[model samples]
Target: MDKNAPKIAIVGAGVVGLTVADILQKDLNKANITVIADKFKEDTTSSVAAGIFCPGSSFRGATLEIAHRWIEDSWYYWQDILKTPEASTAGIMELSSYVFSKEDYGVTRNSFIENLVPIYRSVQGEELKICGPDWKYGSYFTTVKIGCDRYLPWVEKRFIAKGGKIVNGKIDSFTDTSLRQYDLVFNCTGLGAKYLCNDSNIFPMRGQVIRVKAPWLKTAFFGDYDTYIIPGLDGVATLGGVRQYDTYNLKVCKHDAAAILDQCSQMLPDLKKVEIVAHKVGLRPHRVPVRVEPELIGGLKVVHCYGHGGNGVMSAPGTALNAVKIGYDFLKTNVKNKI
Candidate 1:
């Protein structure tokens, strides 16, 4: 390690934090980086997600342009990964998905990626019947899914190989003395930001999903009530789910499981015969506008990049890419001020 390398600290180990570390390791070769978090790998909420590329209509940054860029940049980022041999090893895969809603045609349409993805169009009347005879409104799109169960470990391997350090500890405050020596910090704490930043605007949007062994399921299917069935690696299909706003309970609710199974089975009758793999729950850190900005915290330079809610896996790369650029600029300014 260079004796004078910039000492950088990232205070979360989830997808957002690790992606920041991954980008920093590549962007700033001489930086000594450390990832500090209470949780790691599969223990994180990121693991609970089926990790599809679809973003909620409400997902946004400080501005519409920035929000669109995050999704656009992320799509291309995954596209690059999808072309490489590491795609499978990294748990990234392509998916052809259908989103349908009996009550609203708007639910089937996504303005964000209509022009970006390979396909995004209204589904045919025959296609609506693909899920069930009662389905009315639908749209078909080609997308991507990232399995954090494999992705988190894969990225960690790459990060550690590049000389980055990982530490397991909970951070309750940005003013922690241990962070004094670091030249800058990146707050990718996700839901923890609600407490660390003491920002009431950040709230949890709880989600629950089920994993089933259905080798026959190749494409993904989505319905109203946030119900979705996304296919992943290893013949595992993620069936979900409910979005309970302001709820923090993480335990698997039996009621949720029964409802999810019923909804998913209705979409694909064959799923009723699939073996149950697991049930997972996560609290998405939701905010009106996703926070990704610079802050002066206790005389330390920090870049805040959390509150992605349900879209963390889909948008991590894009926002992390932006965070690195902003952090690099912060480092340059810090150097100039010291000199």
Candidate 2:
């Protein structure tokens, strides 16, 4: 290790943190990187996400232009990886999805990804009946899904190979740490940010899903009430979910599970017969505008990059890239003066 190189610490192990670590190692190769997080792999919310690339218009930043830029940058970032040979191993796969709405036309419209994806078009008269009767409006689009089951491990492996260190520990506070020790600290602690920064704006949106062995199903489907059927690379499809606001209940709710089964069965009746693989519950760290800014905390150069809400996996890379730039600036200015 070069003693003159900057030392950086990333405080979360979810997709956001890992993605930041990945790019940082590449962008600043001489810097010493350490990932300190309490949870990793399946334990983080990044693993629980269905990992779809589509983003709702509601997912935003401080401004509309910044929000649009994040989505566009993220789309092209994943598209570049999708073309690589490691796509499958990295859990990046191209998937076509159908969104249907019986009453609200707005449910079928996605302004954020309409023009970004390769194919986005309204369904025809006969195609409306493809799922079942009572389908009024629908849209068929081609997109990509990132299965975190493989992605998290893949990224971690690459990070370690690039001389990055992984430290398993829950960060109690930012100011409590040795501020002058590291050049910069990145706060990417998803739901953990609630306590770390005492950020009242951050809240948990509980979601539950059932994974089933359904190889026959290829395309993804999204109906009302956050209900979705997303197929992964390993022939396992993720059927989900319910968005319970301000709910911290990680237990599998029987009522929510029953409703998911009923709604999903209505879309693909054959799903009722598929064997269940597993059930998962996650608390999405949601905020009004996903936070991505630099703050000086007790003389520590800290860049905040949490509050990804439900679209963490979808937009992790873009946000990570932005965080890296902020961190680099902090190191060059504030931390350099202290050191």
Candidate 3:
């Protein structure tokens, strides 16, 4: 390791921060990189996520073009991993999903992935009946799911083996004394940015999900009202959820669990019989046009990369790549004006 290389600090150990760390280490072979976070693996919100690649139509970046690029780049990044022998250990796998809506046809259509996925098309005649006769609209598409349960540790091990440092600590502010030694910082703190950056736009969009033993379920399912069924590694499948905007409650609500179980069971009755493995809650860092710009804070060069909401798992790589590009450009100049 070069003792004088530019020091880079990455905050947050969730999917976003770790993804940025992984890519940064790969892109800058000898750059001193450290990942600082208070939580890891199962303790982080990313662990509770369904990890499906399908983004809600509302997922956005600064603009439609930027958003499209993020989705496209992310799809190819995961695709590359899926083709490798280490895919299973990395917790990435190809999954075919069926999104159904009984009310709005628009819900079944995803503009972000329609042209990107190999098999994204409308469901024909009896295809809708597979879930139930009442289903009026549906679309089948191929995508990937990243199981952070396995992915976080998998990436962390590779990162450490590559000489990347991991620090288990909390960063209360960008100017925290602990960060003074670093030349640059990448802020991927997710919802924690709400307080750290004084960012009012980012808030907790609480989501609750239940993991169940359903080895028989191979395909993902989505119904109206934010309900979804996503298969994961092993025999565990995730059934969820409710999107309560501006809600900060992280404790699992039995009522919400009951509703989720009822809704999911209605779509696929077999779910009612599956053994419940765990109930999880995640407070998504909901923000429109996800923050991905550079700023000089207290004479420190910083690049912000949080606010991915529920799409962080699938979109992390692309946005992280973009953040790295901006950070490199920012590093080229010595200007320190706060922006």
Candidate 4:
């Protein structure tokens, strides 16, 4: 370790923060790095996510081009992992998904990932009836699914083994005295940025999902009204969901669980008999364009990398890469205390 290595602090333990930490550790070997967060494995919104690589049409970066780059970069990052023998242990795998829409064909088409995935085309013939007579429009795409349940801990172990420090703590604000020692800070606080930076554009997009024991179900499915069925490792499939924008409620809503069950079971009758595993609610940190820029705040150099909404799990690596790049550049700039 270099005695003059840069000291860095990461503000969240979720997918984004950890991803940033992992990448930075590789980019700046021997740089002192610490991950500070109030939550850990199974507690973060990332864990509740189905971890499918399918990004919604609304998911974007600072621009359409940037957004596309993030998705493409992420695809290849996971692809590299998928090719490794540790893929299953790392909770990364290839997955095929079918999305059906009863009313509009547009709902079935995903412009964001259609060209990126290996296979993405309209469902035809008996395929329409695969999900119990969808009878309208559909598209089948082969993508990847990440199960954060295994991923978070796996990456954490790697980080710690590489001498990265993990602090089970909360950061009240960017200017909080605890951050004074670090030469650079990466603020991947997700929704917490709404208060930390008082960013009005960032808000909670509440989402809920139910995990079930459906060993027989392998492929993923999506239907109208934000309905989705995603399978993960260990025969545990995720059924979801409800997206209530600006809603901050985190408690598990019985109504949302019931609705998710009903909707998912309707698409795959076998889900009706699947054993219930757990219900999860997460407030997605949503903003039109995710924040991945740097600033000098109160003489501290920081890179903001939050507001990924529901796409954080799939897009973490790409955005983290961008954040680390910005952090490297910011590290060279002489800091001048400013508001």
Per-candidate Cα lDDT values, in order, are 0.90, 0.89, 0.93, 0.90
lDDT for 73 in candidate 2 is 82
Cα lDDT of model 2 by residue, 1-339, tens digit: 677888889999999999999889988788799999899999999999999988875798888777778888888888888999989988999999999989878889888889889899998699998889899999999999999999999999999998999988877778664445777899999989999999999999999999999999899999877889999988999999899999999999889888998899999999999999999999999987999999887778889999989889988988888888888777778333332
lDDT winner between 2 and 3, please give it. 3
| Tens digits of lDDT, candidate 4, 1-339 | 787998899999999999999999988888899999999888888888889998888888889999999989889989998999989999998899999988998989989898889899999888899988645998999999999998999999999999999999878877788888888999999998998898999989999999899888889999999899998889999999999999989899998899999998899888888899888899999998999999888888989999999899999999999999999999888775232
TM-score of every model versus the real structure: 0.97, 0.97, 0.98, 0.97
In candidate 1, which residue ranges exceed 4 Å CA deviation? Answer: 334-339
Residue 108 miss distance in model 4 (angstroms): 1.0
In model 2, the clashing pairs are none
Query: Would you give me the overall lDDT of model 1?
Result: 0.90
Winner on lDDT (1 vs 3)? 3
Model 1, span 272-319: residue lDDT tens: 888998888899989878899888786788899999999999999999
Error of 4 at 170 (Å): 1.6
Model 3, 1-339: lDDT tens digits are: 898888999999999999999999998899899999999999999999989999888889999899999999998989988999989999998899999999999999999999999999999799999988999999999989999998999999999999999999999888778888888899999999999999999989999999999999999999999989999889799999999999989898999999999999999999888999999999999999899999999988999999999899999999999999999998888776332
lDDT of 3: 0.93
Task: Select the stronger candidate by TM-score from 1 and 3.
Answer: 3
Candidate 4, poorest ten consecutive residues by summed lDDT: 330-339
Root mean square deviation (Cα) for candidate 3 = 1.4
